[model samples]
Target: MMIGSSNKRLMSDINVTPFVDVMLVLLIIFMVTAPMMVQGVNVSLPETTAQPLPSEKEHLIVTIDQKGQVHISNYPVAMESLRHKLSKILEGRSDREVYLRADKKIPYGNVVKVMAEIKAAGVEKLGMVTVPIDETPADR
Candidate 1:
């Protein structure tokens, strides 16, 4: 019988496949929940058949609740200060566009008044945000 001694070393390479898999799983979870995680002022938007607006850049969102309360980017602003506040927010922005999201239950006069204030704040373009009308027919 012959006995031989061989030199063998343990593996030094780290296995990163598990780490990469966990990272990818976390990324997918965040991506799936990202849209649902967006917090904003609550308002039931009116339905409309109007065409969607061309959006090339971000626009300041002005929301009005059912109680006639005004909010600029989720922060509540008094009606009297809306113009100045909006102007301050829009300063240095060249787009000069604002989108209004108001509750459908609000009076038309209040909406018009808010629009006037937005216009007075030097907003060149004012866009109204509305939910799309469903065209499906109901069966009798």
Candidate 2:
């Protein structure tokens, strides 16, 4: 028997177990964080049966919390200056549309007041964001 001709064969197969484990870990991390990535002021939206609007472009969002505090995107804006802030923000944008999300617990008058201010800001279109009514029998 030749000394250099042993029966051991070189292992050519790639070990994919570690790669699969890493991928699974990344998948789990994304799954856990996906919902939280949609960051916004937390508010309980009222349910509506209206059809969802089709959005062609990103629109500025105005939010009102349960305490009736107004916010542009995530930043708080005073009611006294809401119109001014909106005017300046919309001056350069052609869409001039703003979506309002107000807590259902807030009084309707507060929502109307916010809407009035939004209109005063020269916004051409104002959309109300609402949760769709659940049609599932289990929910009823």
Candidate 3:
């Protein structure tokens, strides 16, 4: 108990037990909650005058960007392969429907090209997703 004795030296090692415990707790929490997270493909949908589409149990989503980049379920696909991919996907489920999410800035020709590919796949029912244009603040 001397005032400045070597035995009274302060502890130099960081106490990591508390930190390790917290990390373990967080790991367990994430493990338990991870599967509960709903995953979705991101795309900027164009606006439409049609009524809102109803939700479905399972549906395929295809996105076309302004630069004419095509993505199926977030996986990028080339124009040459789009037809084959669409055909393969539509072959598995004969009655399955597809939702097309094309950006507003995309050229009409590009959108039409994607539609043509889907039509060739024999997907009878196709839906275009759009975001409603919000009115101006003054109008609101």
TM-scores of all models?
A: 0.67, 0.68, 0.63
| Per-residue lDDT of model 2, residues 4-50, tens digit only | 88778899999999999999999999999999877779788888899
Q: 1-54 in candidate 3: lDDT tens per residue?
A: 567666667889999999999999999999998976644444456654667656
| Worst ten in a row by lDDT for model 2 | 131-140
Candidate 3's TM-score reads: 0.63
Candidate 2: residue 68 lDDT (0-100)? 91
Candidates 1 and 2: which is better by TM-score? 2
Candidate 3 lDDT trough over 10 residues, lowest sum: 131-140
Candidate 2 error regions (>4 Å): 1-38, 135-140
- In candidate 3, stretches whose alpha carbon ends up further than 4 angstroms from where it belongs are 1-42, 135-140
Clashing pairs in 3: none
Which predicted model would earn the best TM-score? 2
- State residue 93's C-alpha deviation in candidate 3, in Å: 1.3
